[model samples]
Target chain A: MPKKKSEESKSNNKGAVRPDGRKVDELRPVKMEVGVIERANGSAYVEFGKTKVVAAVYGPEPMHPRHLADPEKAVLICRYNMLPFSVEDRKKPGPDRRSIEISKVIKDALSTIVALEEFPKCMISVDMVVLQADAGTRVAALTAASLALADAGIPMREMMSAVACGRANGKIVVDLTKEEEDAEDAVDVPVAMSSLTKKIALLQMDGDMTLEEFEEILNKAEEACSKIYDMQREALLNKYEKEGKEVNINDE
Target chain B: MMSSKLTAEYVRSLIERGKRLDGRKLDEFREIKINYGVSEKAEGSAEVMIGNTRVVAGVKMDIGEPYPDMPNKGVLVTSAEFLAMAAPEFEPGLPGENAIELARVVDRGVRESGAIDLEKLCLVEGEKVWVVFLDIFVLNHDGNLIDAAGIAAIAALLNAKLPKITEDYEIVRDELTDPLPIKDIPIPITIRKYGEHLLLDTTALEEDVLTGKFTVTTKINGNICAMQLSDGMSMTKDEVLQAARMARDAATKIREKLFKDKLKELKKA
Candidate 1:
């Protein structure tokens, strides 16, 4: 609670510290499970440390009659939401400004990674729910939701992974947590990238940073994104391997 | 005081014969299945299926200024969408009364319970904080949305992890990962009062036949945090006490199932 201690808390993490007395660019912990829901096209529950997200992908079917159809492309709509009780504090339940913005951001980000041309005239509903949140939630959701889509066998140009980078007390940091976000005098930037193309899909920023600082953050984000990409690959591989054995047995 | 309505009589007959209008028992809860990480762009998300009733809850959070009235507290918002895809009853676009009521009920249950430590969300004493938003979508509707929504909401929250931060209000992308600031946990149990009977979970037909419905939410410490009675129904003193007791027991059972030893395992995975 003291200023000096608070700064120390920022430099030090929960229990473990980095070689530089700071936490390394490590994911809190990545855990995922498939088919937790019975009636969805595909579903997955992913946890990045304490940031938990549930991703459900529904449909490659007809578009709503009222909504205009994209003649040459598929429409992938993404809705990002959090339950009132998902956080430590109780939230009013409704579509507020933040949700609408996040939903739009997510939708735009996913468009870059999905092969919409293949499912022409079809619509895919990607719904992401935040049951809990820490920091880097958007990035975590982007990575986790993509894996869920893959689990459902949705066609994708590549898996999307994301991470947050920012300048805190003149230091660039990776994977911001709630505690650090509160203490640091810095700027936050969250970016999403396609693993296959290694191209940025979504870029958002808050606070202030110099051009050099921004470049550093981008470099850090790229490195962090690769790590997240590895995790996403591992998750999908684990799921497919498990399902492959089941498929082989069914064929027999 | 039996209404002479045929629908009421028919429902009573079904119950008397140990059959529900929807063919379920008095204490029977509809089947529930949950899938996590359904959205490719949500921080935490889950879909809950209870019989034909389906609800998906997702968590999304961002940094913002704390409210002046509650500087130490964070912002949490919950919204429910009763989609036309759920059933013929639900309309498209603008939420109906049912959706509004559902969102308010869940919101009150979580908010009044003081489940999360709001003060922890404070960054600079009203300067900034993390605003967590939860959205609920009713993908299908057979009945019992309260239970399904609650389950999905909590599952999504428990599955969430906090981001690491640095000194000066910035997120530390690489350095840390910790659990979100959770101080309280509330679980809701929905009860339907039928003809001289109290039911734990109800289907659509049962809901239609019921005189009234109420939900009681309890914290992990065995304290009742919030209550919502729908359809403008009132309960007798004895009925209220009995419902409270039933709700407490139900909450305990649900918590055991939802937060099983597997939560730790799920986190480690």
Candidate 2:
């Protein structure tokens, strides 16, 4: 049976039509599944509209190149990759400047939430590959990476979530699409926040916008993130709910 | 190298006492210098120095095919090279993550601010357009390479003059026309959060002890054009907003002070 993602959320910007007809504040349909990869210790496949990403977490295993070992804490490496055919243009297969920067920012966000101290002298690698991208791939990849990390039994201080917010037709909107990103008036900001505590783990933006406009869209993005976090928790719980197991996510 | 614990603790104590090793205020930046025409062969170039850190930015123009998505506009490619001569830690190989991150962040600040009027750079719509290559080189890396490099980029761009084109769309370097059309100036300021204290333009040692950092870029209107958050740090929403405010002020200060002499000379020439 094909899963029917919900898109019934009300529009925040009344009278303004989104490109895909989503509500101004509504996210694209999201589908998240955990442990989809068999060989990886933890994995997740997530989709937001046309954007699809798979994240895999491997090892608190022994560190390679022993000299790189941080005697005091585990080394966490994040790789954000886009497949060659992920986008409309055929991207060269490798770590390009864009992907390198995205990986660094994702690592920065996850580093704040993961309990890396518990796995000293080890290496934990989180990799996210974009199978298809529209826009907001960075945030989508971050969401899947966070889920994969949690599913890997990596200890965490808080549940993490991310979403992109920007303007289309002069109205602030959430989960921007490619057309919106390339729009003349678009001002995009990708935000990552703690699901429950609401602390900002990551904040990045491009495009010129007044401080007031940025603050407004940013607050909306945070609210959307909390909701996405709930969806992530539900998906994870569904995996173990079949066995009548209660996970201690405490996301509420 | 000091132990991470000892270094962090030392820095925290100093911050608690409201004192920096160099005796500058928490929000103070090191002395900054901006010199134009550093590269004799480049179309436009500048060298920026902040305290002991130094960088050179050079801009080269070439005619190239425009992207399919933005066929009527030109392209601006920003790149950074962390040379081994800049610091001991830098290796003599391809740019690792730091250089790539720096280039991307700076690129966003410029591109998103609409600093360059790329549409005007088109020679033939959908056929060819001018490509501006801004290459930044780190000659010395005490700390705060981002701010220094960002300043150099804008200065170099401002220093850039469009070369007169040949009838066949070739760039004629000999006949220069006007300055590159600049709608705005995007200046980026990086603030390091250390032990509850926000330090601006930190040194290498200060960077070593930083709990986190945020780089905020602003244009002439004081609106944010770009921003980047460093690793392993979390801040309250209020705190980030506060940092944005601080970045605006720092950018203004840097702009008004450092670029003063160069702008005057440009008008004179």
Candidate 3:
């Protein structure tokens, strides 16, 4: 609730300033790294401001309980979990209504882009663990999980990015803080997008807003997610470069 | 029987020509049939059939302590029970993720809208309040369960009677007092993307091969109460906007055709 630096609202010109003094369009500082876990086939860590998540991918292997396996395609399972200490209150370990819903949404988002047909009768698992408490954890987890999949060498149509954009204090902003997210007037919309394809992989909205407000936020989220997409690819390329592997990430 | 791969290919072949296996248009929903007051004991009930997909929703009232956060508001719970007889793949045990998502989508749509006027359900502010339970039972899974369940919920809630509150702060199960305080009608419109086509109210066969779906719950005033995109599919920014626009139009059609009297009453009010 404290302002560090004063700035004007960029797009809406509502004359409303963010609580944290960020521009309406400015995203929080982001950090992304791939291959963070050596034991996992692929793993990545992503942070958006105070929110942090680590994602690991394992699969295209034999699926347990053969009945759940797809004979012509791989089954994609995603679990989004938060460490007990990730929040202010000690969250009881295990999936609650919130976590179960979050996990399902993340899985649905990933299922669209992953090339499941490439591995028949196999299963792919993507696990994301939140290490810090903050708003936009689902988006953070999704951003990390996609990178983990790419790092695992699992085929994908495109590398995706996710972000939460909403209205706080009557001004549209990207990557809201937990404080702003809980505000009465908040209009929280979490989205996942593929920049190159101009596709929306996941979308969910809560709080209150008009149709026009929702549309404006969607445009903003698209721009923010595309920017995050570039950052994700850069982090991935950096990983390959560090490993001394010649990965010519072609524009095609 | 054709293999799933073959059936999928056959379905896609039909969709490529803007056709459906059942001779319906790309955006055409199957005929919706509604039967009210099927349950005499329940406070409210409705059976909705979209094509061969049948679902029943029942409303029951309970008196309970209010939650700490909002003591003045009553609680609304929407749950779905998928019967094994509904489909071969469905088991009789716990509610699966699909059932949970169906319930949640319905719940959010109802709660986000001022449909029930939760504040009015409160009797003794922080102590006693009415807890409304809306349960959806799937008797058949022909596809597009969300829309059916959503419609049944709103329909049942519209006709639901609030049980009389006793002097002792208890609910009289058999004695009905008045109708539930219904304000807005939120209709969930599910439009899916099949290749480049945006299909509405798909049947079971068509749902199997669809790439993406957007379940947007639009209120009568054209404002959105809830929105969800299912599966790991992606749509262009244009497509996303198109879906929202489409939802509003479809919701309007559904309201005019089904809840004509209700909307007329709402307008008169």
Candidate 4:
């Protein structure tokens, strides 16, 4: 299924049309599934077309004796992994350097949006595992994990969705795929945003874009994120409703 | 920790019964999976899995002054980090013995093979050259880190290409760049000696049965570049010779697979 879509998207790029014939602003199909992992405190599996991610949320529990607890804040630990078979070529099983860095960046990025002060002396861990990766995996993962945490009934100031806009073939392209990346010339501008206040949570970009282009794409991403933010919320609500029980724990 | 003496004896009994603790054959590799460009930000990246043993490798190229002694050659530095989460035994911050062994074995294989044409990486003779940093990370460990790390490091290097830099020193990366200065391709084959017999592709459990192991690295053209005899328990000349023969055959098979697969074609430059 992913292979066919990739081939179709490759042809679509050559024809100057958005893959799937959606508007430039339109996103590929976004689907979220929650409570997939029975063992984790909260869990979700999400897919944006061929890009798939599984997020497991654990903790808000007592920290190990060896780990010093914060008196006034909660700590969020995030680790991102991609299964070896997730790509066209089978990947190795372990975490790579890029994954480690992304894991750190993600932990820091989400820290800004989560209400850490609410859960003092507790730790929340989010493990985002990419079952398949095509493009925009980081964004897909960030959104999915946030929803999963909400589904798990973890408190937060707001849910976060990350996105990337890059200059490819001299034009601003949103969400690059492996093939499109090869065919075009571009620099990556990746951002993580909070849906609640419409504020930037994390911003990272590589390559050069004019200040005007940067602002333009940044605005586009923000607007796009608002729509994604809604989808993420709906997904979580639907997941809890499907269970036919309010699993919400008391805030205190 | 359990008693090493008792565990060692138990491992010997398993080998005698021809059944490994992990349910693998004496010569079978766990499961091999490879993924390329795992790091969206890396010049070249790959992750490989041999069963639960996972290694992620990425190649980062930078400009640095050449060493005074080796003015015309580029440099390749390999580093390995074993994360605490990868195994229950590994501790964060401080590297354990297994981690150190993993790093040294991988370094020896790549360095001794002379697979990379470092001289070609020199941008300005001895004054300026490219330094390729190969970083291997163990995220999960089931066993057999050496083979996994060796394959991941080279595969990542093979996947990597020089970034396009303009005259102004700004990166001009528009697409996948050119292949790195690769002269020869060398792959290492590890053989573990167990109870007077050597086996190919030992799993973590099988590794426990062995006193120690040795790896033989061979280049594409049947040239042996590096050999390491790991066990303190000495082996006679005949046993070493037999292991070399097994390694050569195993290496030949690995070489065929590397080329048969289209891993090297991802580069569009």
Q: How would you encode candidate 1's per-residue C-alpha lDDT over B192-215 as one tens digit per residue?
A: 775457787777666766645667
TM-score of chain B of each: 0.86, 0.93, 0.96, 0.86
Clashing pairs in 2: none
lDDT of 3 by residue, A1-252 (tens): 112211233454454367765678877778889999999999999988889899999987998779988888999989999999999889999776678788998898888788999998899999999999789999999999999999999999888799999888888888899989988788788999875776887898766567788889999998899889888898888888866644344422
Model 4, residue B190: what's the lDDT?
77
Off by over 4 Å in 3: A1-16, A245-252, B1-7
Model 4 chain A scores worst on lDDT over the 10 consecutive residues at: A1-10
lDDT tens digits by residue: candidate 4, B121-220: 8788868788889898998877677778888988888789888776754565555578886555566677776666667777665565564666666655
TM-score of each: 0.48, 0.93, 0.91, 0.48
| Candidate 4 deviant stretches above 4 angstroms | A1-16, A19-22, A245-252, B1-269
Distance from true location, Cα of B241 in model 2, Å: 0.5
**Better-scoring candidate (DockQ), 2 or 4:** 2
True contacts kept of each: 0.00, 0.85, 0.68, 0.00
Question: What's model 3's TM-score?
Answer: 0.91
DockQ for every model comes to 0.01, 0.77, 0.62, 0.01
TM-score of chain A of each: 0.87, 0.92, 0.90, 0.85
TM-score of 1: 0.48
Error of 1 at A19 (Å): 57
Q: Show where candidate 2 strays beyond 4 Å.
A: A1-16, A244-252, B1-7, B260-269
Ranking by lDDT: 3, 2, 1, 4
